[model samples]
Target chain A: MSEAESSTAAQAVAPVQVHYCEVCTFPLEYCEFGSSFKKCKESLQKEDPELYDKYYSDEALQAKLGTLSLEAQAKLEKEAAKKEAKAEAKADAALKKKLASQVTIKRIERNKRKHVTSVHGLEAFGVDLKKAAKQFAQKFATGASVTKNLQGQEEIIVQGDVSGEIVELIEEGVGVLKGIPIDNVVEVEDKPKKKGGD
Target chain B: MFKKFSPSTDISGQTSVKSSVQRSLRTNILSQWKVDPETFDQIWPKKEPITLVKCREHISIYQLHGEPLFFQHYDGPLFPTLRLVHKYPFILPKVGVDRGAIRFLLAGAHMMCPGLTSKGGYLPPADSGLPAGAAVAIFAEGKEHAVGLGVLKLSTEDIKKVNKDIGVETVHYLGDDLWAIQKL
Candidate 1:
């Protein structure tokens, strides 16, 4: 009885290590319900054939249908396939939109000699605006902040006119500025409006 | 509670927990869970401070090194994240649902009583029945890892007797938005 108690205690202390699928981030057994079931299955088959066989073998599939009827299983599979297609299409559309979006860097004239560079639309490429502002501040030793534009859209405004350097850094993919295409980056000059009745 | 969470908009702020609050929280977790001291220590070390992420509602998440370990609703019982439950499967009493309910559970629906009383499902026997409002790790039929975490809305015996309605209120599930945000 003491030996059995010790074994149980040991078991209680140890944590179980679970294997997760890379494609869907679910456990290996739950990949069937994930949207990327086919990709998960293929990846698992390539990584660990034995484990894949245990989950996907003919006998294993038969055993999994113990309580659920064949018709229910068929319906579930159909639903899973539909979900996969929908998710795939959604991801493709998002990617296309991101690629099509343009990043605008405007050099606004604060005075005759001073200007502030405002970068817009970097968030569309998955970059954190606050972090990018901090990076710009540190890289150029100037004050950079995220503020709303006339359209109420957030943009990073740097203290000095560093539009050329900003474009070069973005092209080089510095820090959090990765994945932004150089071709999509456009430079614009916003001259201060002439004072009325000057 | 985390079915439709998005970190960017939903989260309000994050602050490190005070030592006094951390002590009470540690004790609360020790009493509430079946985890051993050594295992708990490994999960949350003595020197490391936990971050409390306050969301839009009364929900607050406890994160360790950017990985969310647990969350709470108001002053309710702390529920472990599904990822944490997957690693330490024995922390909560386990209740499984049948194969047919797996898809619905993944879609963030509450677990019905029939799913628990079905042939493929399992509940603790009468001698060790759980009371209502107890946290449970939800497993799926023929699956080893937990698919969700929930709180029992009905006692184990009452569930078996009635065998209808929502038995478990799912707090977090496998493919919910909470599971998608691996790091904060």
Candidate 2:
């Protein structure tokens, strides 16, 4: 190797240099266990602007937070406020127009002698299945279960057709219980009572 | 090992849902699995609604296209009908075990960690660190077939620490109620 390269190599072989905080002289990494980085930055900026400026480099990726003029900054803040207000209003309107959501309840004729009432699409109203299922089973005096359908969607299944009373039950209980939206409830099946054939 | 399994109760009712209900159910399923909502309905396809019933002992009975498919527990994991496993095993998370462990797995005994930490069997990704109470499908080494569903009793780290018995509760074995649910 060249003489200069050999000298640099020897230097590289020597003990690794330890970096310390510019303001406190404490090691930077271990600062977290001590006063921390923010304190050091604040102290440097307050006590020694010249050192802080010397240490700061705009070219560094960390130092690249852009500075905006007062008017430009105000305009951006106003736009953000306006967008947030619009979103809040949109949510309020959606919540007010609860009847507009796509929710459907179906009554399935399970077999020859029995009826299975399935309440689907209630998730839109934020209905908790376990509680709802238990309530339905008690209300109708039939077994009820919260289960995922073929498509992995959660639905409440109650034994027998309480379809007519079920809708009213859900609507009335919506307020007392958590998360059953009154307006979002719709019955897709309203068929007349079937003959109790064995 | 088990001589018999908990049985499935036949659903007392019948259901024929609407075309719109079917459409929304498809959308709901796709959304739950986080598949693209915009994917064509024809690609996923629609089928006749299944016969469902509440199991007196378990959560409920599941039938797909009018055939009994799965029996899920209320507070615990599901006992999948082998017919369901026979069709779609890809969707399940899996654990591997050696040929020696396969016999115990079929007889419905819990899978110990010894097989998994040994020569033939291997672990799932260690970085994720399989947590307790998570369900996994057991697939035999070399056979490449899912034998059953299991619930981990302990965390993967704990399993690695102890080299002996009962790492996972065998929820649904190949020859258990899940395997026989299809015939009924």
Candidate 3:
């Protein structure tokens, strides 16, 4: 189609908002189409009649286009804003929750603290195995309950009210040896949920 | 004086030789790697063919100091050749290692290939180490060699953010249960 014809077709297709002029390709806001864009329309027709005829004028072409009504557009924008606000609020809530739940000590001191420990058997498997064990230990620590087996081996039962965070801490302890990465030392003992509701 | 009967013990020595041959055949047939029946037959044309059944019958538990000893599988003898820990050894989730944790990595290293060096991956400038949601650092013991295994704690959200930001599944928990900082 001719440039003018194409431009007209474009205008007919979507009348909502045009950023750039279909003909000149200059930004519509910069073009004469600012405030009351109707004047700009007249100016365009006067400036380039031949160009306008090729693209913009005539009812010969059927502009088969869909557009959101003002109400619909407004509703869409409102919904978008609501979604954004909800996301922001959720993020804020999460941050606040994190801050609130953090274990704060007036002073950081090293004191030997004792808790029930369940250390997994030594596994010669590679780092992946260690990581897997760490994850399992974390899961076991948080969600699962713990019991002592007849054989004296501590058994961690990942069950009701158990969480993933507790398991993570347990795994962290297991992965270290004098602050070095160690293999397969997941220990768990039944205790009250440390933080966060079960 | 030494035994003067050379011929008498000579035949016994031959029997001992036969026992050694039998042991050799047993080891070859009973070991993990199995040779083709045709090849076995060809190799032992003169001796009786030791089929899988015969091999099993000949197998004996080799013990050392009352302990059953098996061959130690070695990927390689050198520490450098040895592969680091697999995807997941212990069950930890969302665990990540930071530059500080990477005391194992060498100090002076240059970018060689993809993933090996931070030069190409989304490693942030040397000031604060790479930022969150950056690409995975695949260090191959370059200039900054990893001295030992370094551990880092990461949360599930952190992992998800990294994956989402990187536009790919870079870091994944090899195991269902993931170990994190909490337990550490």
Candidate 4:
């Protein structure tokens, strides 16, 4: 049989054991036990002792004790529902966190973009600045320099300061290096960088 | 001999790698420099761990006064391969010449491999008593041996011949120290 088909058959024929912890009935052995179920029972007991006592009575439990105690059974189902709800809540929280991180990161990146582009009328290429600078230096024969500051971040420092036409040439050079559309330039006050690239 | 020192910023004109970029630049030069393939193999051997950390950015030069002490107590050759990068120089503290990593040194030979950073997790103290800041890879085939990238004043052909005699490939250069692979 194929791998998928074999797996399905194996699963169908396999003896699945549900592990329930003796004290808490927590699902211990990889969800085989009922730790969560006991947790539910405890919560119910804490929330309303009178309801817990009524539901957890020996006689009532004995009636449905074929597979599980009535109280334990109720507890397991309640726990299952709570677990699904908890998982959904967690997923929602994670999504929100991810979006917030992205938004913050994008904002910082956008702010930095202004500086790289502003000085030389060149937009930030953002692709391994050192490599790009090396390539640019080779092509333009302008002896472009790549430096890394104390912080281990890389930057491409191209020569010649310009405003209108000179700025356009530099921008063109940058475009040649980055192979991307040049955005508008904005000034950046960056610390003098050191040199390094792998 | 009076200790020779230079300002770390002088890179364009300097031939000898400065103290700050010594360790990294040495490794890079050794890795990049011209060498025959067969000779490269004999001088420089390949293994899992890339012990040398590349620091081509900024180097800080210093004229150290005293010798660094290794964890082990042996007086052999002291090949100084000392240089620290810009701000991150203080990443690992130096007890003497040898900096401590994940594996805390128990004795000269025995080390507990905690395997913390995937570089085998532990390092025994260097047998060489010198305070050389060398990146050594200690492993066992039949017995234990150590290999690291070091800086030596040997030419390309000399390095190749050394590798041929040593029966390994490629010499890793760590500024001023030739970390020749050798059986301990």
Candidate 5:
């Protein structure tokens, strides 16, 4: 038998196990569980087969919650849509939070002809400072290392005015694409870049 | 007597390599440098197009869409990132020269054996020394910064054997056309 077919059978003495909605298999909070029903599908359909059948044949779930075939379909659709929208917003906020975690890229003037570029705060986003520093130094073709800033936080220090390059590297997702977890979202408001592409 | 230094003029200009060559060059160079391939590829991805413009018998200037990226010196394969040693110090073996020799070196003079053997001069440990014909970062004494790239005609042992003068026959010194040619 297929996996779904096999899941239809119910067992006694069931452990307090989590069950999913049969139709969608959505393990959402709205889904309920118990014995003689392996999943919410069995419970909901067994209790109301006509409702389930009509709901599947419904065109849209949101138009009517009445006795129309689309009534339950509408509710399920609304539930799924609300959940999807909430999840989307939450993900967007989380990404914004991660990006806004102060990925400060600074070009400190050390002396005449010797500038130091420091990329700080990326470690909060799960970037390995040493690895990121090596990539930066290699990209700009300069020397760089993972050193402690005045705040004792780990930062990447490179030996040049790589402020421009550092920003581009981040914006272009150089470190992020390499599993840095900066979300790889492009910042639309980047200052006019001088280096076309390096 | 110090043999007068003569640099081979650049020829065989502006040659493009296929994607295969670029991939191989990237692999070969990073391997020779003992760098992790994953990290190097992540940094300098395969998508970037590189052009090899021959600058000398042993060296070529690598360009990315006509913008020079680096100068590469070849022994068996490309050592493209040698020019970036100021940022990555351990890329090559380093030898320090007296402060007095800095001016001559930057003026594109061939580093004499005496310049390296004289007071204030330094040579890398013979055992751990860079093999002859390998790339070296020539740093000046006290300043402790690389002045240029050079290839040794004689190994550290050979330099000691010839003891009175010339340790390395300079390949590309500071202020040379290659150094000033590309702003990489």
Candidate 6:
């Protein structure tokens, strides 16, 4: 019985095209339950007013109140509003923290004349450390890998002293390095102290 | 099952499935799901090899070009990802909960019998009632698209008769960590 149904469905039906809300990524019909329903509604109203009306207009709201009582509907609205505010505050805090975070590129002296550049704190800006290391390796033709630093945080270690070039690339917003603010990128030099002299 | 998944920390490894394994998997999926050959092909092209992303625990996610299509826990039934279910809703049998349960469902709660047996809810007739342990697309009252996916803990008739406790154990839902991942 199932086989026959599947064969007919295979011949007759096509996949449904679901339209998702850009703000919350939920289907437009389910946006009311999303944390950013107000933003989703606003964006939908702008992008597709017809759809917005179909889902959000007075007639639609009346029809949607099917078995749910008025008291329950009012409570749901209040809860949704509270959730939206909380989510908005959380997003604001995250953005502020990201903006305040710094990316440190350090040049460490390995020998008398050799140096290795280690970039720290790029992950805070949402950069993929492995992909960034690969990009650096390909761009400079040198070995680059993501490794844990002494602080137990992940950092990209490039085999050459290309800290200056890396800074320039970050400032230029090349590839995955985009969206990192130049003001937060600081370059530091670390040299071993000479024991006998002092 | 995918309520708290993080790819970087949770995924153990990813490997491309061999042709023989892929063939068996294809047959398993065809038998398990209600999808047809053409629709299945549209979701997962025949030529493209699927990558098996093994996560912590025994969960295995099958991905086509970084987009997760379906997943399974241990040897349980193969459940399509919520995103895939949204695109091809008919792939699974549907059960709907009432509007009052929508908020709790979004919070990753299991579907209680009361929510399913309510006036706003819907269930298949006794003649076509689904058996226990069946994968189902969970829809909400007055909503056009599915909001989650689950496995029926009890048969549809039993759920109507019992009218209490959890009816469907939620495997994936809207706003879950899995749904947040568009690509991996």
Report per-candidate DockQ. 0.54, 0.01, 0.01, 0.01, 0.01, 0.55
For model 5 chain B, the run of ten residues with the poorest summed lDDT: B1-10
**Model 1 segments more than 4 A misplaced:** A1-12, A196-198
Q: Who wins the TM-score comparison?
A: 6
Q: Residue B17 in model 4: shift from native, Å?
A: 10
> Candidate 2: DockQ?
0.01
Docking band of candidate 5 = incorrect
Instruction: Give the chain B TM-score for each candidate.
Output: 0.98, 0.73, 0.16, 0.17, 0.76, 0.98
Task: Put down candidate 1 lDDT per residue, A1-75, tens digits, no spaces.
Answer: 123234446334555688899999999999999888899999999999999999999999888887998898889
| Backbone clash total, candidate 6 | 0
Question: How accurate locally is residue B3 in candidate 4, as Cα lDDT from 0 to 100?
Answer: 18
Give the alpha carbon lDDT tens digit for every residue of A1-198 in model 5: 133224323421112233334443322122311111224445567866765554333542332233224554466456546655665678689887776676766666565456677777777677767788888778889999988877888877888887776766776677542434344322222232345652
Q: Give the candidate order by descending TM-score.
A: 6, 1, 5, 2, 4, 3
Q: How much lDDT does each candidate structure score?
A: 0.91, 0.59, 0.29, 0.31, 0.57, 0.92
Q: Model 2: how many Å of interface RMSD?
A: 30.5
Per-residue lDDT tens digits for candidate 4, residues B119-158, read 2222223442212233233221111112122222222233
Candidate 1 per-residue lDDT, tens place, B1-184, comes to: 8888999899999999999999999999989987766778877888799999999889999999999999999988888898888877778888999999999999999999999999999898998899999999999899888999999999999999999999999999998999999999
Model 5 CA deviation exceeding 4 Å by range: A1-198, B1-13, B55-59, B72-83
Identify the CAPRI category of the predicted complex in candidate 6: medium
DockQ top scorer: 6
Worst 10 residues of 6 chain B by lDDT: B34-43
Error of 2 at A14 (Å): 63
Off by over 4 Å in 4: A1-162, A174-181, A186-198, B1-13, B16-135, B139-184
**Residue B97 lDDT (model 2):** 77
